[model samples]
Target chain A: MRKAFALIVVLVAIGSAVPVILHWWPMAPDISADGHLIDQQMASTMVEVGSAFLLAQFLLAYFVYRSADRGTHENIRSIPGGVKLAVFVAVAFVGAELLALGMQGQRAWAIQYFSTPDPNAMTIQAQAGQFAYYFRYPGLDGKLGATHPEKINEGDQNFFGLDLEKDVAARDDVVSAELAIPVNRQIRLLLHTKDVGHSFYVPELRVQQDFVPGLDLMVHFTATKVGKYEIVCTQLCGMGHHSMRAYLRVMPQAEFDDWLKQKASEQ
Target chain B: MRFKIACAATMALLVFPSGVWAGTITGKVKVDGPTPKRKVIDMSKEPACAKEYSPTDPPRMESTITGPNNALVDVVVYISAGANDEGVMPSQVVTIDQKGCRYIRHITAIHTNQKIKITNSDPAIHNVHPLAEANREWNQSQTPGAAPLDAKFAEAEFIPVKCNIHPWMHGYIAVLKTNHYSVTDGSGGFSLKDLPPGKYTVTAWHETLGTQTQQVIIGGANETKTISFTFKGKAY
Candidate 1:
């Protein structure tokens, strides 16, 4: 029974660790041009963390097996370093892992967040509400008209509430339910929330950004693939949070231009 | 003299059908007690709706609209029982419009299986989400100038419809089995005319205020009966 117990512990540890180490269930394909760095960071962290986890599990199983023979309290003795040494080792080991992981992650985070968007990059506005997302593109003038929150009438199909009659710039703005962008073209997306805090997450694009109410935040990315991906809200804003989703379509430049034109016609 | 009497009787039958149009019920719904001040809607978020009203006369919340004489607007008064028209479907398509981000008619009473046509007259996009417990709920999105959306409720229910995109916008769609229903106008007046002579369980429903029922009886003669309901006022 003692031998069986030890075997079970070891088996459980290996059985749980192997599948994750090999990444048998991988993530969706990365479609963003800069997502490679993020993927590298993620892979490195998983490997490093997985090795530590395996080490701890193996040590636990080995101790359990060793103690099985010497069951009495008479054989239980303090280690050479005592409890103090164990605490120090734990702190040092965990602290080093965190510092290393954070440093590695900074490379991936900085490249996407720290750099300035190119002047010619397309600018799109993304607005998050209780249960839906709407995207607006700057039309031919390459400029977005000023937005008035008071003018937002969803019944009128005016989500942004731009005064199109008075604002010529707003008349050409194209709003779409889906976020469509040209592949390989840098897109500067301005994020705003109409109500509560919400997050925009797309696994394939390796992008997850939150919209802080009353504040406008920007995210820039260039998609490498041309396909449709799901853009879901990770924030639990309200009862309809689960249904708060939109589509992210990375299209060819010509197709994207035509889509924008069609949306503009709708406006 | 006999021929003249026959002509007069025939004209009376033509003007008012014998069993169908026996009597009419007319009434007003009044709210009792101290009225709560309505919250002025901050149209700063909606310039189009706001531009129409001034700072001193801003748009107010439509949850409980009150008028002079303690009048309650937007209440749905219908015959719940003792009416012969139960399960009779209405063929007329009731039209509702979304203008200035508000439902043009706050309360709509339609018979079960009656078509309700919803149109977007605003410049922005609007979505219709009906939270119905007795019937299958549905959601639809409409753009400006898009075609009207028509829907039907298969069962009787008081479904609350809202624009998820605009949280403040809300209205009610009352689907009843009987065609004898009337929604109170601005003056809190409602008249269910051409009701056949019968005892009716008249129910008055308010969105914020609970429902009240009063028994009304109509004689076989072409007479008009009066009734009224008053809901206890409370601050929301």
Candidate 2:
């Protein structure tokens, strides 16, 4: 019976480790990019620490079971010293956990908020709508054409309609439906919204940003892979939000230039 | 500037530089078969969503048809021109609105990178969801009388738009890379405007009818043609 109990406890311990093992051995892409490597490492350490705690409990259970099985009439052994040590270790572990959490939180904050725009980065303006993302390039002006919040309408051929009547820079703005980027280059994205709030998320590149009206938020990332990827708006903007898809083509610099030239000729 | 505008207008009519060639593709996207009964927009799962507005009641969907030959409105029938040669806007914008918790127009044409407008006219808020695989999934809400929005497709995808708050609110935005396209009207009729004089493959797509492709040649003025698409199963 004692052996059976010990075996059962061992099986339970092993059973509990399955999820931790799978989590440590993830096959899919991490949405946090490489930032989550630390998190995964911490999680693995946490699993080991939890296994130690479980082992301690199992040891105590074994001792009790053995005493009962032997039918002894003596008093239980006192491990006050060991108990105090365990408590101390637990407190220290908690403190370490809190410290790690704080460090991770700060890193996330810096990545999300404190980073400044790169001066030589390729910039693209993105506007979120009911179910789509409208991308605008400054053409040769290096600036967006005038677009007033009220003057923009998809109807009447006034899309992103930045009241060219009012916003002069908008007069020569070139708008496109697709988004293209050059490989190995930092892409600075300026996010805006014409109607509702939407989230711009790309899973393969591990980048997500929000497009909010009245305020412009920026996000930057470099494409290491030269291929086509889906640029989806994760935010629920409206009835058509599910269909809000954009294409992100990461190509060699020369190909990207050729594409730009073709687009310019169309204008 | 006036001469330039007139020159542009004349060019538009000339059908050469404007690419407004001859031999146009015209037809109706009518429901030639049995149709489904019209039901009110479903708002059961979202209980508090009803409270955001005045009366806690869902609006009736007048877009639904209850006849044998009821045309599927808002069904985007467009030409898949192919991936944009560049990031240019090769297609025109198709406007689809949300009025009284249901999608307006019922059908429209969609081309790659074509802009889409979603407007809300009702007093209550509605959550719009685009459950697309080729595109990213998204959900957004428009408040009562919110300003119209501008949406553009980044890739070629036939993405259907719906309302999460109101499940019955459904529509489609067909994204193709082609310029030869048209949306079927209430009578199931369609039109492909302004083609450069050339031999091109014309295609018609319905949200329910799958797609049909044909080859035609354009020479000069508006050339009218008729093409009909039939669905095998009953339309719900």
Candidate 3:
């Protein structure tokens, strides 16, 4: 019965590792231009972690099988190098793995956050409220208008609270629920929250950032592919958190220009 | 017969000037100055709602609705003081429907602890958010064909409710302690009935034009007192 139990444990361990080893369910495809660096870092971490997990499980199974006693008494013995070797291996392996991961991860993080956006990158502002996201683009003047919280009358669809009648810059701001960008062109996004805390998450772009109530956060990325992707809120802000989502459309330069022109005309 | 005697006694009570009878207060709310033009709402983002309106005719903002002769609509009139029974919640439920991405009633009145049934009648989804200061603030989303959302306010408050998904969709839920309240219709007419004979303060509140209060006295049973409120309007 003990042997059979040991056999079952080994079988279970193997079964669990098979799918992971075969790469059955991989991550969604990377569609961002600079996402390969982050993907590489993720892959390296997965390999290291997967190896450690398999090794630990196999070691556990071996210990269990060896410790199973027979009818006759047998003398117990310590491992070859005893406690010293075990401690040394644990510290050395863990320390090395962490150091490597941290170094590579720092590079990936620097590429996404540390570097400044390109000079010609298109700038847009995204405001997240209770359950919806509104994107604003500067019109002909290329200047964003000032936002007045008190002037925000949603009934008139003055969502950004721009004093268009008073503020010259506000008169040309174009607001939309969908985010449209030119493919292969860098875009810088300024994130603001109208009320409580919320997050902007785009899985395809490998971009996620929280919208702190008082702080203004920014993220920049270039989409390599031209398609429609989903931009969802990750933070639990309010009752409509589950349905808080918008479409991110990446189109060709001419198409994006036409879309912006049409939107501007409506405004 | 016992039935004849009861009927006679009831008839006597109705005929006699009993001090226990309730009265009604009817009034009209009007604006004194020029009314602001309602801005056209751009519902282009919500295609489903935009399709509900003709391309040439879109829904305008209903914040400051005014009719001919400066009659104000969507104004809430309620007894602010001198109520015999305070915090008496009604048994019936008040409903607010979201249709075509707009609140069916611009202003809804309910007593404290009275159940409010919010229904989403449109094909698209909507999030009902009430920004209540005295009462607890809450937000809820309802999808198409989903069950109605139930809510109740614990305190009296003038709460502004809006759909976060459709920012242009806005309404008000006035939670009052007394059941004697009325919302002005298109003709700026409101009637608060079943109000006991007493000296009470009647207040009228508009979403944009602000609020006005007047002290009124109900003389006797079956008496209908009339009152009028005039609010100053802003050009902008």
Candidate 4:
């Protein structure tokens, strides 16, 4: 019975690790230039964590099998180097593993958050509200207008609350429901919120940022592939959070230019 | 014979002595001042909607829709006071259709516990967001060809409904305790029927021009009372 029990434990461990070993249900394909670093960091963490889990489970199974007898009183046996060696292994191995992961992970983080965007990067503003996201591009003037909360009226579709009559700079702003960008070009997105907290998340771009109320945030990334991806809100903003989604279309440079020109003309 | 009797009964209810069975209040809403200049909405972001309108005749903001003769449209007139059956819920469903990326009716009124069926008629997806202050606020998304979304408000409050996807699509839903309400038409005409003989207060509400109320007294069931509301407008 003890042998059967240990065999069952071993089988369960193997079964649990099968998915990770076979790479089923992995992260979405990395489409951003800097996403490879994050993928590498994830791989290393998985390796370390997976080994630790397997080792602990195997050791537990072995102990249960060895102590299966209930009738006889046997002297307790310890590992070769006793408690000190166990403590030393835990402190040294686990600590070093964690430190290594942290040190390597910081590079991936810095590349995304610490480094400044290129000077020629296209700048766009993304505003998140209760249940929708709107993207605004500075029109021919290459300047964004000021936003007024009190003047914001969804009825008139003055979503950004720009005073077009008074603010000359706001007259040419091109707002769209979709985020269209040129492939292989760096993008600097300035994020803001109208009412409450919201987040911007694009799995393919490996980008996720929160829009804190009253605080404007910015994130920069470059998409290497030309395709359409869905941008979903991760924050529990309101009743409309679940339905809040927009499309991100990464197009060629010429196509993007034409699209912008067409939008401007429509305005 | 039974069908003939039913038809006769309905006709009798419709065309009886003018005031013997129940009284009705009829009125028109007028703008007291000059109409406000509407701003042209730029729907270029949403090409589907933008294509629906011509460049020469773009869609204009509908905050204040005034018709000929200073007639005020989309004004919700209701019995604010002296309503006897305040808790009676209506059994009929009120529908608000999202067609051409715009709410078909700018203003709609429903009694408490009544169902509101929202249908999306445009090709593009739409999210109906009702920002209710007193009642529970909710947002629902309906894709093209999807089933209509149903909702109900338990409290009496005015809700501003907007489509998050199409920012310009906005409307209002007025949830009232009593079923005695009417929305003015393009000619500013409105009628509230089947009112018991009593003294009541009628209130008219406009999205941008604010609200006005008047005291009315219905003497008998056949009496037809006339009450008019005039709202002051600005040229913003």
Candidate 5:
């Protein structure tokens, strides 16, 4: 009987280690924006909860099973401090878990959606269309030029329909097919849409924001990687939704300056 | 004046076939053996799209032009290197209508520099977004009964066109340098006209099934060649 109980303990230990071994395998990793943080939290919680329950249940089962197997005529002797120790340990572990959950939840809530951009930070207006996003820079003057929504025509070179007669700043507007941002800068994006709803998702940097037509949304991110990444539309806008892809150039400050100059010349 | 000249040329070509010294490249894309399995278009994200239409049927959707009967609607048929004029006649205008909230023709072929007149016949406003690497990306909106949106592609590329409002709306614009290419019918058949006698690599391409290249030698003018390409299955 004692040998059988020892075998159960060894079997349980091996079973519990299975999950730990599988974690290192290259599984389907989440590649979406905000995917890293969520994946890490989920994986860690699984390990913590799994280990805690497995250890507690294994001991409890062994004790109950061993006690039952004792001869019917034998009188059972209860350990004096066993119940107290179990209760104390269970409560303390649960309390610790609750505390950790509360702290993590608070941090996630605050960082995910509640924060506002710095007042002096750079702001760019993003307009989501059917198949591509049209980004407009606020020229030398840091204010949006007066736009007449009635006259937006890409064929006639009036894409953002700036009332140049009324707002001189609109005439100097710089627009590009690809988005270029400087690395290590605090950037805020003001997103709006002229047509159907589209989502702006960047997996590597961990940011996904939906562009609502009637309402404008704001997204902020600091580019850490200095390579070109794709800005894919997660939300299906139309038939061309799958092909509605754009390039984002994250470059050093000098190269970004040169690109801006080249775009300015074309505009 | 351009129409009158083209009419006169058509009559002249009909009277004297040997005058042009060009061979007719004709082939049919027969959806043979068994009707190829229809692809299930994933419209899960679009709530307002018409649910009654089975995905197995080509999406009855359009932006500038409607596709040929539900069979691969946006198949781009073009002549890469061919015996044709470098300049396109501006007077030849092909009007692709967006009626019934869809494009009239699913596949449209245009000369590299030729203009395509896109008219929105529906009452609501629609934004035309062309997905193409060959041309500058542009999105423009057209209202009902408004003056047609005349747009042009400066280079040769297969541009997938769509409307932002209708998530199911899809079509393709096959911009070719030569004016000799012709789109296949529902049976997967295509015909290229006015080819000077020479050995040419004839190819058939589908949006779903990739391109199948075949070699053909054309010796006699106005020669008819029967070529067939069968694709196993297409990967999404």
Candidate 6:
């Protein structure tokens, strides 16, 4: 019975680790300039945690299998070092592992959160509502107009509630349903929510941020590839949340200029 | 035999007339008691629509557009029972426009087989999501400069339509089986012309106020029955 139980435990451990080793469901390819750091951090954590899991399971199985059926006359055996020593070892190893992981993550974390965007980073405004995303671009003056929540009429398609009639800066602003940026150029995306909380997540870009209601947040990233990607809301806002998504289009610098010009004309 | 045949022929002509039904039901809907102050909509964040107002003249809520003398502007009156309408759904299309972030006709009724068109006249995108129980629920996004969307409901129901992107955009589309319906105008006076002389359960529906029903029996030729629905005022 002991041998059978040990064998089952071993089988379960191996069965779980096989998928990760074989990469059955791997992540989408990273297309952003800063994705390498995040990928490295993720891989290191997985390796450190995975090895711990496999070792713990194997140790448990080995102990079960090695346990003996002794007569009443035999003395119970204690572990080699005692509870205090065991506790010390656990604390030392686990503490070291945690410290190492945290220290390793600083590199990625600093780049994502601590550092400010570049001076030449193009600025864009993104608004997330119940079930959709609307993006705005600063036009000729390189300035985004102030927003009026009441004037955000969907019927007039005047989303973002820009006062075009009076606000000269807003008259030329370009709004689109998709996020388009020049490849390799830093993008400063200012995130705002119309109503409830929402999150902006893009798997390929390895970028995720949340939009708190009544608060504006910003994230910056540079896409290395000229391709189309999907931006989805990870936060559950309401009934239509599941369908909340927008597209990200990365194009050449000249093409982006032309695109922005066309979009501005459409405004 | 000759007299009996002549009487039967005259009765048949009255029952199945080649001309339109001459009976009419006309009346006014009044709201009783004190009226509620219109709730001012806060559009401070929406600068486009907010610029039109100031601290003393902010935009007011428009859920129920009431006229002078307590007349309900958007009430829909129709035949609810006891009338057999065998005519086909009208070939004319029913159009609803999205303008200034509001539905052009707040309350619209169309026949079961009739077509309803939704157009976006504003510069923003409007997501049309209809909350329907008896019929299939559908949502579609209409973008500026895009073609208008057209659809029809097979079953009879009163569906509340809203713009998901713009929470303030809301209206109702009453999918009805009868073609003899009248949506009350600004004066709260509605006239249902050509209602055949017979029995009918007349129903008046208000978006804010509840619905009311009255039974009318038209016994005379080309009868003109007058009826009125009085609803209590809502403060909120």
**Single-chain TM-score of chain A, each candidate:** 0.95, 0.69, 0.90, 0.91, 0.67, 0.93
Docking quality of model 2: it rates as incorrect
DockQ of 5: 0.05
Per-prediction interface RMSD? 12.2, 14.4, 3.3, 4.2, 14.9, 11.6
Which candidate number has the best DockQ?
A: 4
Q: Name the lDDT value of residue B150 in candidate 6.
A: 96
The residue-by-residue lDDT of candidate 6 on B65-158, one tens digit each, is 7788888877889888744563457889999998766677878888886898899877666788888899999999887768999989888888
TM-score of 3: 0.71
**Candidate structures ordered by TM-score, highest first:** 3, 4, 1, 6, 2, 5
Count of residue pairs whose backbone atoms collide, per candidate: 18, 38, 0, 3, 15, 15
Per-residue accuracy of model 2 over B1-236 as CA lDDT, tens digit each? 54553454455555545453455666555555554333223232233333443533434343333223655544445444421222446555667877545577655456556778788866667777776787777877787778777777677777767665444456666666766566655565667766543444566665544666666544445656665555433522
Q: How well is each residue in A174-228 modelled by candidate 3, as lDDT tens digits?
A: 8887899999999999999999999988888888899999999889999999998
Candidate 4: clashing pairs of residues? B19-B221, B19-B222, B20-B222
- Of candidate 3 chain A, the 10-residue stretch with the lowest lDDT total is A70-79
Superposed Cα deviation of residue B129, candidate 5 (Å): 8.8
**Against the hidden true structure, what lDDT does model 4 obtain?**
0.84
lDDT by residue (tens digit), candidate 2, A1-267: 766777787678767777766766653354333336445445655765676667776886677567656754666577667888978988998788667666756665575568775689888888777655667777777887766666643322244766654566765565655687888787788888877789988876666778877888988777767787778888777655665777777889999988776545433
Off by over 4 Å in 6: A68-84, B1-160, B165-236
The parts of candidate 2 lying over 4 Å away from their true place are: A1-91, A101-112, A156-159, A212-214, A235-241, A264-267, B1-236
How good is model 4 by TM-score? 0.69
lDDT of 3 by residue, B1-236 (tens): 54553454356455754335557899899998877567666665566777898856767788889987889999999999865457666789889999888988888998889998999888889888999888888777788989999999998888999887777789899888887889999889999887555677999989888889998876555679999999998755
**How much is the TM-score of the A chain of model 2?**
0.69
Which tens-of-lDDT digit does each residue in A12-125 have in candidate 6? 999999999898999889999999999999999989999999999999999777773544476557867898998999999999999999999998888888899999999999
**lDDT, candidate 4, at A24:** 93
TM-score, one value per model = 0.60, 0.45, 0.71, 0.69, 0.43, 0.60
